[model samples]
Target: MTTAPKVALVTGATQGLGLALVEGLARRLAPDDTVYLTGRDAGRVAEAVRAVPGGGARVRGELLDVADPEAAALLAGRLEERHGGVDIVFNNAVMRVGPDDDPREIIDGYAEVNNFGTTRVLRAFGPLLRDGGRLIVVASSLGTLHHLAPVLHDRFDGLASLDEVDEQTAAWRDAVKDGTARSGAWPGFVNIPSKIAQVAAVRALAERRRERDAARGVLLAAVCPGMLNTPTSALWWDVGDAATPAQGAVPLLDLALGPVDPDHYGQLVRHGKVVPWRP
Candidate 1:
């Protein structure tokens, strides 16, 4: 008997780590399998499809802006009709805006792209994930644990469940609105809060799967591919030699097609192992 093809979705696949993911995902695909490469621009996404290894025949292009929930829902709808359901949903879209004078705008902007957008994509495509499927969130572990205020540290690290996560998002919004976000030690960059939020969100989602729907082994994880030396990242990362984009894609590719370790679900992976997660 022949096994059916799998449907994999990778957001922001026009360049950088997202582009690299499509290439790695392609290696794992059988001839009939489909990997959807999505980005904000139709032309870039279409061009990116062909840039994949193996001539990108099995790769399909879709356009999406991570913040647009309607676009995400529409894509998920089309995927369901085309393939019955999707096997993997890779939430890799990202944004790093400046620390403007009005920190609230900066915070809201980052949350919209990195935190809110990630959750929206997951919520839209999650139901479509077949049993034993994977939900991968591309995150940075740099400030996930140790970079928040003393009061906020505990909540960030011990985010017990998804309900608490919603509460946390609300609190963040309040902080941004009240003009106390920076004074609260929320960090100078949006990447800090954005990544922390990513980890918390995935952990909460995994907890839900464990509690309410254990029958379907849909694994969720936030993976930090380390600081990669991609064109966009190299300009700011003059501190040290970083992994090439291909090197960064290893953990994501492995987890996307793995033995399905439940422990890894909701966990943050780094350097190919699930570290202490302390920060």
Candidate 2:
């Protein structure tokens, strides 16, 4: 008999890198496989499911807003009841930082959705990832250690637990509010610091994942898809005619459906390969 088909899920799948990722995954899905596409807007989710390549038959829509902790739990329960568990989860839902939004709004919004929101999603789905599964956090190269002081770089590399990760991000937000973030090397931008927190969360979760469940084959990692020119890019920052989201989606998709290797677990991938995150 043939094996059961895999199940995948993508958050913030309406447009941009999220949408690109959905399309890329759709093209590779086995006929028996199903990939869930989710976002806060039901209409957009439905529309996205239909618009993605090969999505009509294989993609399922779920109304989910990652910022809401309850939403993750609710969706997790449904997945447990419906599909038993999921094989891949891509956490890409993020709150964009407007050009003129207050530092407080920028910092707090990023923490709530990008950091804590990702935290909730990971916790909610941690138990539901099948053996030999993967959880990929879509991050940005701007979050890398190249911008941080060596001390801070080591600190991120050595995050011991989730609580510490939470505390660390909170401190950065506080620094922004106090007008010291610039000097502190955080610089008060939503994308970089938020992605930093996401990377830390991946490491934090990877450390204790097996203790909670014995399957022990889930790979938790973060990735910084190179700057891409998408509809959403101009709203945040301008990369003059940069790589398309389709080009960016390749690395994220590779981690989802590539040769299984334990060495890739808990590392930050760039362009489909694990790279030195600390440098």
Candidate 3:
């Protein structure tokens, strides 16, 4: 008897690292496996599905703006109805546009789509993940403590506790209501906030999974695909001399199809190595 193929869903697969991930996984996995390639642009998603090097028949496209609650819900419903459960869920979409009419407005827009949109996707589809399923969040090193602490110190008066950070975030929202929110303080890049938020969310999910069952066998981990020569980092793409999209796909693919280790759950893997995020 033939075993059923694994089902994988990758968001923001239309271009850049995300597209490379879809292609890499499609080439690696069996032809019977299924890959749900999602992008906010329908045409782009379709194009990505067709662009996979091998097992094109196993790839399918879906127009999903992950930040949209209705869209996430619809995608979750469709997955549940068709696949029963998803074996892997890859969160890779992000928005980094800046120099808005107002800086605060730009920050809010980035948080809405990058942070909140990712949360929505996790919440919507997390339950449909199989017992041993894997959740791969494509994060960035910029969000790591080593990087964020210095940036936070430069921006704020002092190092704030997580609660204090939440309070500040809330205060920013309140200030926005009164039209007093400051924009100069918001980080311009898309990776920083989104990666930080994704790391926190993935850790929380891992904890919840453990509490649900120590033997549940599910794995959730965030990965920094490294600075690739993608559009997302086009402005600074020349700064450090980035790697190719194929090179960037190595770590992501390892997280998806490689060995399973409970100890590695909730950790951040980068450049083919596992890095400690917290002391």
Leading candidate by lDDT? 2
Q: Runs in model 1 with CA error above 4 Å?
A: 55-57, 98-105, 154-167, 211-214
Record all residue pairs in model 1 with backbone atoms less than 3 Å apart, i.e. clashing.
Answer: none
> How would you encode candidate 3's per-residue C-alpha lDDT over 1-279 as one tens digit per residue?
866678998888888788888888888888788988999997777777777777443888988997685888799899889988888889888876633335445656666677666777877778887877888888877655554544443322222232333344445445554455334343444455446556666665666665552467777788888778765466555635788888788778887888677667777778656776543
TM-score on alpha carbons, each prediction: 0.88, 0.89, 0.82
User: Which whole-number lDDT from 0 to 100 does residue 17 have in model 1?
Assistant: 87
Per-candidate RMSD, Å: 2.6, 2.6, 4.4
**Model 1 RMSD vs true structure:** 2.6
Can you tell me which runs of candidate 3 are displaced by over 4 Å? 98-102, 149-190, 211-214, 237-240
Write out the backbone clash pairs for model 3: none
Worst-scoring 10-residue span by lDDT in model 1:
96-105
lDDT by candidate, in order shown: 0.77, 0.78, 0.70
* C-alpha-based local distance difference test score of model 3: 0.70
- lDDT per residue, candidate 1, 164-186, as tens digits? 76577768767876868767677
Candidate 1: residue 44 lDDT (0-100): 94
Q: In model 1, how large is the Cα lDDT of residue 110?
A: 62
* 164-269 per-residue lDDT for model 2 (tens digits): 8888888887888777877765645656677777887887777776444335566788888888886567777687868888888987888788865666667678
Candidate 1 TM-score over all chains jointly = 0.88
Q: Cα deviation in Å at residue 266, candidate 3?
A: 1.2
